[model samples]
Target: MNQRIRNCAAAAGLLFTAMTASAANYTAMLTGPKEAPPNSSTGMGAAFVKFDAASHVLEVDVAFGGLLGTTTAAHIHCCTDTPNTGTAGIATETPTFGGFPLGVTSGAYSNTYNTSLAASWNPAFLSSHGGTTAGAESAFAAGLASGAAYLNIHSSLYPTGEIRGFLTGAAPPVPEPASFAMLGLGVPAMLLVARRRRKA
Candidate 1:
């Protein structure tokens, strides 16, 4: 019985480690009201972001419409002083995301960034965070986890930022295949051991 308990605890530890190492998903509903110093532009947008710490990959998707002015730039800002409020400097590519739609009131964008590369981060942001891609990646991930990261879209009408939203949501971690297999075998074995002890 003691041996069985040890085995079960080991399996649980494996599962916990695997789950904690997985990727995270985040989403935001962008609107003028969510913007700092709120606007009345009637524009709306949505953003979806996924980050894989192990792979150092960041994926971003955005859709927006009904803007009062043409699109100018869009990027992510991070490490706000307060969560879900306030403003922060851009943490993503400068000017705008690569291949982002320009001069359009409504558009959709999808892009994947290799966060391991310098091109994926704003120069100032990267410099401030220990001047390395790894440092920037770590800081960005922390910002997202703490609700201090946001997606913003700038327009001709509101160059500072017409519509924006704080990114929220940290998906439950998923266990790796090996961890799943361990749980599958360990759980049944644990139950069998318990049943035998009960019979005894």
Candidate 2:
């Protein structure tokens, strides 16, 4: 048992060392509020976005109140990395909410968000949203591994977004596999330690 315990400990230590060697778990966040510009029937729009580095999943939550008249449509555009509305692309290769609001208007409209699809997107999207406010998770890795990403908000009146932000920072970066190795090894090490201590 002692030998087994020691072996497990050694294994765990090795794994921890390897895992700690690197880390990953980045996240970028952005919000859209009434502060949006007066482009749509309303004056502004509101939005909430969260990106998961590991899963590369993007979760979005947006609400536009005080609409000029009612809701029409909205979008996450890729305009600029720096804050403010710019002329960019719409990098929503995959979407959560394409161009429709969550029923703010009383007219014909529909929104489609596939929960199964990964919300994580390229920097182009983030730049469109706003470099300062828009956010992306795992985006840093994708950027380092590929490039950057951004976000943008738009409406019928302002088909060009009214509010925008960006996902800045090196990003949380991907977690080191070694840490996972540690977690895997640690479980056994802890079990062994507990058994030995209890044995006494």
Best by lDDT: 1
What is the per-residue lDDT of model 1 for residues 119-183, given as tens digits with 9 covering 90 to 100?
A: 99999999999999989988999999999999999999999999898998843233345533433
The CA lDDT of each predicted structure is 0.82, 0.39
Error of 2 at 110 (Å): 14
Residue 198, candidate 1: Cα error in Å is 44
lDDT per residue as tens, model 2, 1-200: 99999999999999876654433221222223322442323232223333334334444444333333333334444434434333445455433245444434221122333322335343455554444223433233344222243444443444444434443433323334543242344323433443353233
Best by TM-score: 1
Query: How close is every model to the real structure, measured as TM-score?
Result: 0.75, 0.39
Please list the residue runs of candidate 2 whose C-alpha ends up more than 4 Å from where it truly belongs after superposition.
Answer: 1-42, 79-85, 93-151, 162-200
Q: Relative to the unseen true structure, what is the C-alpha lDDT of residue 20 in candidate 2, on a scale of 0 to 100?
A: 44
Per-prediction tally of clashes? 0, 47
Q: Candidate 1 regions off by >4 Å?
A: 1-21, 170-200
